[model samples]
Target: MGAAMAAEAEYGRGERATPENWMYRPANGWTYDQVKELVLPFDWDLVDGNIVVRGMAVWWHNRVRNRLYYQLESARRRPYAVDSEQCIVIDDHNAPKPDVVVFDETGLDIRTVVQIPADKAVLAVEVVSTGSRLEDRFSKPALYAGAGIDYYWRVERDEDDLPVVHEFWLHHEAGRYVPSPEQPTHTGKMTTNVPFPVDIDLHSLIDG
Candidate 1:
């Protein structure tokens, strides 16, 4: 792989339009610092020593994300902040940015900090985009759980084109995510005790 890539870089015979980050290969997975050096766009993640470029979300996908973020951010108070498409560093080998991150202000520096460590995150939410099925369904859950994030929520579009949130928590003993019993497979409204006690009414928010 290394030799092939080196040859490719040397010849420059392929499309010159490829982004610089695509050509990056380190012995270890890309670290937060290394990525910062690349100066790539925000729509990327580091997974198992590979860089995954995230596609742009469709209209409906953005709608779901916006509504969810408003609900979480409005209800929360001091020392906590909500953001979209922010990086969460799990370790050297993995850094997957969930769509919405519920993070606390504890030890956070507003300046010179591009990513948050996993421990700073209270909850991680991923709204399943068409291009992100595998990452949202399998890879992200496992990565977040392994990093010991207390809460993880996955939002999917139902048959009726409404948002359905599935909540999970790290099973500390099992070292994986176990679906929250209190939060069933439902839509329109979400009332749960996650990160903190809160109730959200997503009903009609998707409509005009």
Candidate 2:
């Protein structure tokens, strides 16, 4: 048992540490210090749950990450920060770490996870890594939409295929995130026009 779990030992019965049973039980909230300590020793993810780590998922994530770093070097208007695998507190109720998050240049800084406000994100990207593809596809989209995020990208890689980045824009008319009418062409490039026009070569990221 980790120090964080020991400190929050009051959480009875439902106090499972596995993703299958561990849930965001806000009745006994966890502080960032607690979350950090617990994550240190285990190959686990501390979001709303403690997901046991998967090697393949970690592999795919790194593939995309290498390409993103290359692309960031050439970006026209750089984001305040481009953070991968860092938690952003949307509010008291929610905090999720997307695979790639771009913030406003003005508010970017190296601070605690709680300081990275979800609402300040201009773009949130999630790569299908392990459990709950539905969480990345459906659940997170709704959460980001509600948080008023301008852009959300779902990067999915299937067993025998290349990765695909599905674009969703927050449609002002319906106030929901719907797939863009036209799929981006495969110069392997795509761009976001809402927060800023960030040109990206999608093919390069997926190819790796």
Candidate 3:
């Protein structure tokens, strides 16, 4: 088995483990420096005062993330920043590490667990993985929408390994994400005008 798979199996598949005070643990009392020092070669996040071990990203996942980050960052204007794999604290108990997060310059902090207030978050993007499908498709969207984030994007790889992007905008009154009128295409490219203008060439992002 691969390193990531081995780690997942050693830890547990997709289930959050209880917080423990170890050198590698990222709890409320731990500093970012400590987290960096101890969690080397492993992906970990702070969720509700607990240290959550995240499954490692496969090569394709990293590739798509890198490409998507570049596209968003290049098009991003002042006051908006695009980041990859940053923790966004949803509350005291939930901080998810999104594949990409675009947030405005408000409530920005210089802490280990950088907190992006829900209102300041313009968009949250999740590139779905086999182990993360349920959380990415349902749990995360609900959490982001409930936190008042305006937009969410879910990217999935089709049978051909090309990306299929789903766009959703929050319906404040309904407190959920309503699919945008512009449906995702199985071919060509995907574009969006909200939060900021971004055009993602699906082919380039995946195969290039």
Candidate 4:
């Protein structure tokens, strides 16, 4: 909580902590290495210079992420890897971590801060939480698209607490995401061919 508060203070400073300071300022370095020390002691993200504390999610959220991870993992071929809660560096000021990210494995570093470049990412998926609905459905898609990321997916919980998946692809000419046509299904299945062929059984994945 101390690190979280410090990061928030730094963000509040606006122009005080410039990119130049990132090279020399000890506090700036601590914020940059949010995961290195236990100071922050939680999952945090930098969003347009603001520090976002990623608190724990509901059981359904974890279950959905795990289910999607394994599904994507089984479909993963050479040169592609599936990861959850990984940070994608949109720019120096913004790096929003997604729930599940599928990225190219070439030139990947397991050590240090694993900041996957937007271009190297095949897809960024966010399972929407009540606290993150706006960022997940709006801010993140815009940021990811603007960064030239190819694909984006949003998983929303319905009134019945069931997962509903939405998929989008980047339209470079428009510099925005174009939503994929909704799949017609009676059993609450979502299917998409972008990034890779993925068929998600939302009902089974959540209810199981």
Candidate 5:
């Protein structure tokens, strides 16, 4: 009984497969590669020196990611490429995988890229899900801003379950995210002239 009680110390409900011998910053930072090596079941992200389990993305959620990636891929100016579910490594201690990302391409190649460096990232977009609404709306914006990623967009669902785009840009002076004048909060569709002429039909994200 004592041994069983001792075994469940960290995560009380942990089972045999639960990892042991954890490490984090102030001693040494856990790199993305090391985290991947653990090969945990659920998707994980390194957040503020802790490993966080990301909520499972439902099909509709992923559909938004794919459609956004496609829309941005077609319209973005040169040197920027779009990808879905790619990890943006802000630093050794923080790496959150934004649902969609626009990154400065390394000579127009996505093949060799496995993880994106934050400095090369142009924008980070998160699609709010049932379990991730708070993180997507607040925590991740802070992290992205700190990494100097200039633009951030968060997508939330409307009453009819259509997409709503909320745009923001890093306020370098204040070190936080603020509404982007380039594009205002858009519902059902995103029609914008500034910030590089993005006109995405958000309603079409779902297949009829």
Candidate 6:
């Protein structure tokens, strides 16, 4: 893509559009060093004007992420990035950060400028957070589907309840994902055929 297109896309993908964190705000842009210092200690993630942090009920999220990370590694897949708070610039005006992004390893080499497009991400995961259910279950799915991503996972964790739910959706048709009917209930495994066929041990991965 052209530089202008990429910049426009980046701006749209929500990297703290507002003046929060005193870093990349509209009024006064803080230096990279300043932003780094402010963020290094906290579990905060900036997306456009929104600041997302680990929710009070976030222990489950950590468990789920760790487990998934382990499974991916064990499978011998060269995941380009995981748990990096991917702020996919969908457009110049909006961006949402996904919890995990799996891409081809070769595309993430820092020295290369002409890398694969963000739309080429193989799979994306969202660990549900308080006040984030809609965004995770709805908004993000639509964005990923529109971008032609092959897989999207919603990891639902609730320490207060049993049977920590893990929902899996696979994009079958363009811009749409269809959940299987037998829908792997708690502790069941599901196989996805899109992007590439893979077996996922849903129960073992999400229920720590």
Tens digit of lDDT per residue, candidate 1, span 1-208?
A: 8775674454333222235535544544455555544455547788885778888889888888887788888888777889988888898668787889998877888897788888888899999988999999999999988888888898998888888888887899998888887875557788887787768766654786
Better of 1 and 6 by lDDT: 1
Model 2 segments beyond 4 Å from truth?
Answer: 1-9, 12-56, 76-79, 108-114, 158-160, 181-187, 191-194, 206-208
TM-scores for candidates 1 onward, in order: 0.86, 0.69, 0.75, 0.78, 0.82, 0.60
Instruction: Mark the 10 consecutive residues where model 3 has the least summed lDDT.
Output: 18-27
Instruction: Please give the CA lDDT of all the candidate structures.
Output: 0.78, 0.61, 0.72, 0.73, 0.77, 0.54
Candidate 1 whole-model C-alpha lDDT, 0 to 1:
0.78
Model 6 vs. true fold: TM: 0.60
RMSD after Cα superposition, model 2: 5.5
lDDT of 3 by residue, 12-113 (tens): 322334333233322233332333334434676654344555677788788887898899999998789888887676775566778999999754665643
Clashes of 3: 1
lDDT of 5 by residue, 1-208 (tens): 5554454353322222235633222224455555644566678778875678788889888888888888887898876778788888887668898988888886545667668889898789999999998899889999999999988999988888888999998889999989978665987678764335688888888755
Please give the RMSD of candidate 5 to the true structure: 4.8
Model 6, span 1-208: residue lDDT tens: 3654554445443343333323324322222222333443345443433444535546656666677666654453444444446456544323555776676666466575332355657677777777678777786787776766666777675464322334455555546755544443344555554334456675666453
The true-versus-predicted C-alpha distance at residue 199 of model 3, in Å, is: 1.4
lDDT of 4: 0.73
Cα lDDT tens digits for candidate 4, 1-208: 6765665456444334343332222333334343222235456677765566677788999898889888898887778988888778877667778999999878867785357877788899888887788889898899999988888888888888888877787889999988765542223886666677777777877775
Off by over 4 Å in 3: 1-41, 45-52, 106-113, 184-186
Candidate 4 — which residues are off by over 4 angstroms? Answer: 1-38, 109-113, 181-187
* Best model per TM-score: 1
Report the candidate with higher lDDT, 4 versus 6.
4
> Between prediction 1 and prediction 4, which has the larger TM-score?
1
Q: How accurate is candidate 6 locally (lDDT)?
A: 0.54
Give the root-mean-square deviation of each candidate in angstroms. 4.2, 5.5, 7.5, 5.9, 4.8, 8.3
